[model samples]
Target: MSTFQTPQYTIVELLNKAQCGELQLPDFQRPYRWDDERIRSLLVTILRGHPMGVIMTLKTGGHNVRFKPRPITGIGHEGLKEPELLLLDGQQRTTSMVQALTGDGVVDTEDARHHKLRRRYFVDVVKALGDVREQEDAVVSLPDSGIVTGNIGRDVVLDVTTEEKQHAAGLMPATVLFDSARCFAWMMGYQQGAPERMAVTQQFLSTVAQSVQTYKVPAIELDKDISKDAVATVFEKVNTGGLRLDVFELLTATFAGDGAYFKETGEDFRLAEDWARTEEVLHKHPVLKEMRSTDFLMAVSVLITLSKRRTALAAGKTGKQVPQTSARREDILSMSLDDYRTWAPQLRDALPRVARHLRDLHIHESRGIPYSSQVVSLMIVTTLLGERAEEHAVRARLNQWFWCGVLGELYGSTITTQLAKDAEQLPDWSLAKSSTTPEAIIRASFAESRLGSLRSRQSAAYKGVYALIMAQQTPVKDWMLDQKLDFQSYDELQVDIHHVFPKKWCEDNAIEYWRRESIINKTPLAKKTNIRLRGDSPAVYIDRLDAKGLSAEQVDAQIATHAIDPAFLRAGDFDGYFQDRRRRLVDLIESAMGKSVVRDWNVDSESTDAPANFNEPAASTGGVSIGGEPTPDRTL
Candidate 1:
């Protein structure tokens, strides 16, 4: 017999098999991570005749191992049976279809704390028509707009058009399209009085169903002789999008076969459960909540390998210490179940300490965290040095390094190689005998051009600037509210990062949009202040504030605290203002660093380069330190 069969299946047929328990997901597949935008995009791709790649499945009895099978979610459960086929790849696209078609959410297998998934997807037939012509159009599961995903149900109208005549074409629930009887009934109810309208709706629905029923997905089935490792290799190679699977995910599936691997504990060890617990631990940390499972796994790799190496060194089994590198793909792929199990606790203990260390450096939240790869280095250094890692001297160097990494944009691009090199220095930094400073490495990587060219809110340097603003204890007061500004309470009230000179004023004066949008012109202001300053020049607003009984000194002090040059406010000297402010800001940065490290922009604006000693250590201002005792169990 041929080892396997390659056959095509329609969307309806796949959903039926899944609902009937014949088609199921493999136990090791990652949880559904598709947001509404992705789901909507998939529908658009399908409707427009785009080739979404084929899904791969394995014959259940063909493999040597009796793998545990899971019924596809979003459809109501049928009695569990031996699954005939197991989905090996395309979980993301497949899960999206199930959710869109059935309006059922798959339980998030990754999040143990919250084992629920609820999302409502819809499709705007009116909108989909413009993009998809009837010459080659089909029905989509959901509408293109107003997609809302969460635990709670939100009532949404699918149609977004505003004309009075299009009222009948309002949002249609995409889930009804999966059922012919329901769809027909809905059409009958919708077009009861108008036969012509009914005919049109019927034609549209029929075309959609026909398209889905005839759409073919190409496939390749593995022969029965294929080994489990081969399945993993093929799975990774086939899913080139990198959205569905990773080393940790593959390992999670690989370890699933090693049932009762922990012989001594009497408790069966499952990689998926352990992975979720690790995520839960990271989620509980105030600074680490923004961390992804992939990031946590990288740290876990360090915790496992480094500790083992340390033990080997202590035993004199190894002649000399080797510099540790960042976690590699091969290291994760070849990880043993036992090693993975032990590393979970170490990660739970070590990573929060890394967060606390970062928090002390005035990185209040994840957005303030310049590069998460810095966590890997922090984990290794703290784990090696123990309590002394949190010493004032040690933290100051780390703080300086953190800023340098941000300003230098060290981890912005080419992250993996840079992380490997940075990780090599941890051993030296951990030892008191060595004179290695992380700041030196950061300085070598630093470039003055990055700081001068910063304009976008998305750039790493922009976040670093915000962190620096908070670090210097700049008095960011809310004059309108008569209260001290608490930057941390950003979630409670919207903090507007508005232009110092109103955009309308800039447009009126025909100023370049890029100059108006520069980081130099951006500052956090209250929504009220932003709205009230509409189209007003800086000079005009300052005068208005003065008219409201605020003295000139008070206005100047507030603006100065925000790093603005008060002299530039005279007649709105935009060019001179930017130059002066940039100079003073660079000065403040050097003063904060306790050295004249940063160079100001020359008049030419093209050659804003730094001094020759850009890599030298700035004079220390007794080092950056903060409150908070280094305790082992810090929770969110």
Candidate 2:
């Protein structure tokens, strides 16, 4: 292998050669995610002639690399052939420069299906140039050309091809990312267009070109000693205190580190001021978004695939060599993206079967695992069965796999071996499990367990677990779609989870915790009624309505079946009618599970579940609990 030397490369010359396709990005590169503020800041720095870093690239074998365009629109080059040039170290600055100085912006991408690819847009270079100048220069007419430049808002034309000077404003003839080669100085600073600054910028460019003669770029060479894991560590170290680029950022550079960038990988190259829209394609995909459920885990998983073939954590990180990491990279790129397009049919078919299996199963806690085991299972199931998880038959496979993990015993969940066991047994199990609903599978998983974890639905323990479990994917709509939970097709009427005992009222009565927030106490009601009843005491609310129209008895009757018509709107007398409702809920909970919880309190008795969180009678006044503080009671 040749040792890396500081080769002389002028900024303009490098960019021009790159325009013919020299610099490239690897497949792991993500689209731009910076918002406008950051983009403007970078452009200002460059336009002011601050030296941006060198455009670094690793030398590689003569094999041509593919170069995908940063998701941008307009007159930029859309594709470049191999040996592709990967953007290393200076992506942010480069992208900002291209987007702001050039009028080229990523408008919309079109897939082969001709579906208008929804892309995030970026500020054209004209806007960026406008941002750096004094405010007065923003609207100033330029020198007989549409080009707007600013030292202090003066305008200059870099290129003018249109017939009319005024009509040219629409063109804003400047170099964007696509046509950047003509106007860029990648390793140098930008030449500002304000009349005085233009002279200075031109001087700066010339000086930069001369400096390349001995420009010692303090650089590390990409070599066999640098494995993917090694590269990841290096990245983590560099970003200890600063804002860290995510794992994908590191992994992309590693793959393209040998200076091979792929043009079709769809990296976000600052097409929009809103950086989140950078990778509109990846973020919009149901599968990619769904897989992104848990950021840390998903981050590692994506990089693992990209770094080298799908490594199963078994490959010890001690390889300490380049070829091995490169082989792994090949495996990552080897995984067929074609699998993504076919995901809907495959995964969608599996979710319902998995949902049915989990719909009624009683999971237990209090023994093998502490309290809050149910949520762990819930998160895992949701992930494996959530909208995107259904891709590639993830649900049916996960359904079968989960059953296998639990079939060993009731408290059979082992984070370590669960995925493996399921993976091992699933091929045959999926056949029988998908076609046949395994009632035994649920019992097989939780029989010896207490099932107490299932009872504390509204506890903080449950909420924390839930928050940790979800992947926290963005564009929440994509996730909902993956879960098949889109409620749009349903009627105007909707079901809302409402507090049956009127939490605020319970607080006043000192039994707030159990009665107010217990998942057991939550019920479905019409959306409007839920809002109207927000915190009204259910008993008093019903009693007040009696004067208007509804008899307390009639309200009680209606509530008994979990149905309510808001005929007594705003009357606020819903509580006198709750004793029967509480009883119904208890009965319903037991009925739903074919078992009973040891709830001894009566709905009519003033004695309540206030003591559930250990609050005694002394603390029960003024809506306070034991210790003269509010306690979370489990009964009402």
Candidate with top lDDT is: 1
lDDT of 1 by residue, 1-636 (tens): 565568877777776677777878877666667665466567667655567888888876653433556776565555766677788877788777776776442223222344433444444544545544532233333323334344465654443232222226534455655567765666665566666666556665777545544566666665645555566667657866665465556666556655557456655456667767766766665566666555556656665666666677667775456424446555555556678767667656666678677655556556556666666556656665666677777666666666666666565433444545555565466444567665434453333334445565545566667556545666555433333345454434455467888899899988766567666677766677667677888888777766656677776776666677777875688888877767656765664454455444464644333333222232223211111111111110
lDDT of 2 at 390: 43
Query: Whole-model lDDT, candidate 1?
Result: 0.59
Q: Candidate 1 clashing pairs?
A: 122-142, 122-143, 123-142, 123-143, 124-143, 139-208, 158-171, 159-171
Model 1 residue 249 CA deviation in Å: 2.6
TM-score of 2: 0.44
- Candidate 2 C-alpha lDDT tens digits along 1-636: 543344444334444444555554444444544444454444334433455455444443423222232322122455654533345444554554444443333223343455543222222323433334541222222232334466765655343334233223322222332233433442122322335346534543354223322233233334423344444444455434235444434433333333212355544332122224322432432222222211222212232332342243356543443223111222323323232123322332342433333321211111111112222232333433346444445444543334323222222122222222222233334434455433324333222111112234333222222211111111111111122112231123343345655778667767535334543345544454555565766545545445546565655444433423233323343343333334443443333333343565544445442334322113222211111112222111
Worst ten in a row by lDDT for model 1: 627-636
- How many steric clashes does model 2 contain? 59
Name model 1 segments beyond 4 Å from true. Answer: 1-25, 30-232, 240-243, 260-262, 265-267, 275-287, 312-324, 350-368, 375-389, 427-433, 439-452, 473-493, 546-551, 591-600, 605-636
